[model samples]
Target: MVPKAFEAGYPKTLGFRKVVKATIYVKKKEGMSDEDFIDYYNTKHAQRAAPILQRHGIISYSLTYHLERDRKMIQDIMHGKAQLMDYDAICTFVFPDYLALAKFLYDKDGAALSSDHDNFMDDKLMKMMVGDEYLLIEDGNKVG
Candidate 1:
């Protein structure tokens, strides 16, 4: 179930304690190997964005690369035989709230980070969205 704070169209303010999670779907540029893409994003991009994220009220950031073992699942989905999951990587970020996210976007730091995306991935191929998390399970146990 969706949390009350995240129920309304606008995120409910709870002393800036609620986190706004942004899920980013990324695609590497042409000729870039998967290893290289993951390396640059996890190391170079993340390193450079560390301070910028802190300044923007981001509490955490994580990158999940597509694994070789998951290739079959991806192909099946792409071929319309399975669920949708067409992305090379998933980058998750937790922010203090939506307002902070907005401030980050308008700030020069945000612009710098936006430009940095060109160095490792294709902007035209990236997709991103922000939403709150709902905990329906924990450590193999259901929590509803």
Candidate 2:
């Protein structure tokens, strides 16, 4: 998650815009380890997603491996912060507009990318959380 201060400043500097955040938790089924999932994301899934993202209007995105504390935070958010099995990874994206995002979602390339991701990872037991925030910007510059 972005620091609260940074989140707060986003509206002021970048102006008002919409932010879409997605948190994906890949839970191992008994024998699977967190490292295995990370490797799959870094080595296999990321390679496939990169091209699709570029083809779309994705301005930027990041993939992060959660540390122990971060994992705790995820658990906390999901279940009042109680300790739970660590999450596998976190992915975030910043886009220009909802139409662009929608286009990416419904496009053939996007479906292919999603299919590739499903093929590379074990998402049957995965948990995903998504949220959106709209901030009023000072000027139109931020929208662009």
Candidate 3:
């Protein structure tokens, strides 16, 4: 989640503008412990990414870990069916605007991000996209 200070003072009473949403899925490399992978991501990788994201005009960045308990709940909901998603973590990167996102995509900073991903992420297992959010409800009130 983004820091409260970063949130705009006014809500988008109109439709929300589209923003880049880079959702990342991590694949733990062979022989690397899960603890090590998470530590490097949270400490070294994420730490390094903050400045780059800021420079690229990203609004917020956050990581969601796939916990064992959540996995069990998924299995239960599926009635012992197949796994819906197989990934260790999901990362969301929000950009201020599509133009800012485009700049990041075509700039050297993007290359740096890609290079860093090579060190800790499996490109083959990754899924990313830029999307707009449609708010159906906000604070229990209907929204456009």
Candidate 4:
């Protein structure tokens, strides 16, 4: 059965939150191993960006590397033929509101971040999806 919450449909019915979430798909630059890419991003990159994120009203940011071995295993279990996704990593960021997000983009700190991208990842291979968040679940439980 569709939960009573979801049966109503869409954000308002689901108790929409004003926060926006941006999911970014990105690929490493040529010749960087997965280990090197993850290391540089986790250690050097995030350290540099922390202040900019805090200043821009970003609630949080996280980046996760896509595991090819895990993908292969899942495909094997399903008896499915599959190809790897183009992206090497997925990065997510949360913003407090539209104004916060706009400021994050147009502000000087944002410019610094944009300029910094060339140091590690392939900017040409990046894609982003931005949208508001609604909770259909909180922690491990369902939400109504």
Per-residue alpha-carbon lDDT of candidate 1 for residues 24-105, written as tens digits (9 for 90 to 100) = 9988777788788888988888888778778877878888887554677677767946554667788888876776666666
Sort the predicted structures by lDDT, highest score first.
Answer: 4, 1, 3, 2
- The best candidate in terms of TM-score: 4
TM-score of candidate 2 to 2 decimals: 0.56
In model 1, which regions exceed 4 Å deviation?
A: 1-17, 67-69, 72-84, 139-144
What's the lDDT for candidate 3? 0.70
Model 3 poorest 10 in a row by lDDT: 1-10
Backbone clash tally (model 3): 0
TM-score, ranked from best to worst? 4, 1, 3, 2
Model 4 alpha-carbon drift over 4 Å, by segment: 1-13, 82-84
Clashing pairs in 4: none
lDDT of each: 0.74, 0.60, 0.70, 0.77
State the lDDT of candidate 2 residue by residue for 30-111, as single tens digits. 5545676667767777776777777766777688766556766777788865655555566766655555556667878677
lDDT of 4 by residue, 1-144 (tens): 433432222454446665778899988878887778888889988888778788977888999787566677868977887666878899898876666667777878667877767877999889998886778888888877
Error of 2 at 79 (Å): 18
RMSD after CA superposition, every candidate: 5.6, 9.3, 6.4, 6.9
Poorest 10 consecutive residues of model 1 by lDDT? 8-17
